[model samples]
Target: MKKIMVVLMVCLMVLNGCTKDNTQDYTKVSNQTYLLGTLVKVTVYGKDVSKEVFNGAFDIIKNIEATVSKNEDNSEVSQINKGQEISLSESTYKIIEKGLYYSQVSKGKFDITIAPLVNLWGIGTKNAKVPSHEEIQEAIKKINYKHITLDQKTNKIQIHQPIELDLGAIAKGYVADEVSAYLMEHNMGHAIINLGGNILTVGEKPDGSSWKIGIQNPFDARGTKLGVVTIGQKSVVTSGIYERYLEEGDKQYHHILDPFTGYPVENELASVSIISNLSIDGDGLSTVVFSMGLEEGFDFIEGLDEVDAIFVTKDKEVYLTSGADEIFMLTHEDFKKKQMKK
Candidate 1:
């Protein structure tokens, strides 16, 4: 899922840097928070056309939320949650189909069938609380991507076991891609789609320049800088433990849990960001890499030609694949020196 706190922090920083006289005409829309979460921002560069483009983009986002939201009473996902076979919109069905495929590709690391465990922990909900060992085991028993049955003929979905399907990890990127496609089809030349940190840059600025995207520092929430990446038309997605988390006594629990253990994966990684041509691919890959840890993720990225990854370990050590080094620009002198030494 998109980290709410980190995105808000980035927005606050961006807004503080901009003056009212120089603010761009950006239309922002946020879904119901603490539930099936999603936020979309569309900015178009044209006179009297900003509102029209924004409305068009907003419509697409709303349609996606309605189709995929688990909290929606009549949504296809909600029906799956209730263990009822239901027909879904072609778009929604395609997303679920892709999700299951990715789950297999990642060796069950990226799972949409994790809704039961997510709800049990209430990570992003008002009732956010931890669950007992027994409770988690029971939830895992019902959590299996193989249990989701799809009928290609009718586009119907059937849950072989009692489970809830949550696409929180992948839906935002898919929505962003959809909105970007809509804008391009409608003659939008230059735009930026910031779905609350799941950013996708389409075309370029009207002045013909690449969009500047800053990578958030995983350790210090407000202090330190990671680096910056320039993109003309690409997606940048970062998944970190510092995002949505809960503290209890002297320990802390993050929302990104492992389906195998029904607890957060214990690893040295602080965050992993992926850049790809498609936002949905980047979104799904980021989660998969995080769960796989540094070495395995590194090996996996090295095999892919079109994808690049940036990983920050718990020791504050940074690792970037060769593909990532092309777009990543180190702003900190010390970081630059460290890279040179390596």
Candidate 2:
């Protein structure tokens, strides 16, 4: 009787272990709080994974915030702002270099050096207020990416003007890419990293399904869905006038600003979302497309290959590039009609 009881106990323990393993096989959700302003949620899907993958991914994002955030006293961006030439990590240097290139490519439409203007407007902060014309002009004078110089020999960065560097636009996407890479390295079969609205998918769901992302409708405040895009192993980023804004006395001001004018960009579109292989590219393109009005934005999308875009105009018109039309599903009746007509 004792021998029989031992066998049964061993069998029960084995079955319990198998069940636990199966539960972990489908999805493992982990979240880390860092980045100074946002929460990073990482969902890994695989079997027999350790906590190390999550820790490593979280560390990458934390390191990025340490390196890039102007709010951090020890950050490289802070050093540059204080007129100190400081050496940067390779990842930090790459992101800034890409930011500078995009700033030039977009003709200053998307700029990291517009931090002064951002602070003056204070749309996303507690002190949100409208700045005077003179204040805006002074802010604009300090807002030029060209003044930021990079030393190739020492990999050091310097800012000629008294300007702050804000990576609010692209840092999340870059961190998403880094986290995705970390997951891939750890043989994480499938994963989704949603840094606020900046989403990156690696492989597919555990059941071999594509990742579905919902684009928020700019007109709706209660998270109404504008459309849905299904993608695998790609990054989806959206830049909108709705995400962060301030309203006062029948006037509304958004966070995205025109670097030259130091005011909110006056564009026909309410929001622009980009889907691309590289999360950083998607981040940069979303801002660029939003700054470009409808006509120029459509032209830019048509010129690109492998990059898809969806634009929601202020008039509630939805525009999809040839590539985007394949994966996006319209949820609203008006947009459904428009999609049928196309």
Residue pairs with backbone overlap in model 2:
none
TM-score of each: 0.87, 0.88
Could you report the Cα RMSD, in angstroms, for every candidate shown?
A: 4.1, 11.6
lDDT for 240 (candidate 2)? 78
lDDT of 1 at 54: 70
For candidate 2, the C-alpha RMSD (Å) to the true structure equals: 11.6
Model 2 per-residue lDDT tens digits across residues 51-113 = 888889888888888888877899887887787767988877888888888888888888888
lDDT tens digits, residues 1-342, model 1? 334222333320111121244346532322222212544556665434655667778878888889898879988788778878888897788789878987898888778898888888876556877788999999888778988888999988877777778888888779889988998898775667777667787786555666777777776654356787777788888888876776667777777889899898789888888888888888888888999998888888878988888887776677888878887776654443123122
lDDT of 2: 0.74
Let me know the TM-score candidate 1 reaches against the reference structure. 0.87
What do the candidate models score in CA lDDT, each in turn? 0.74, 0.74
lDDT of 2 at 260: 79
- Winning candidate number (TM-score): 2
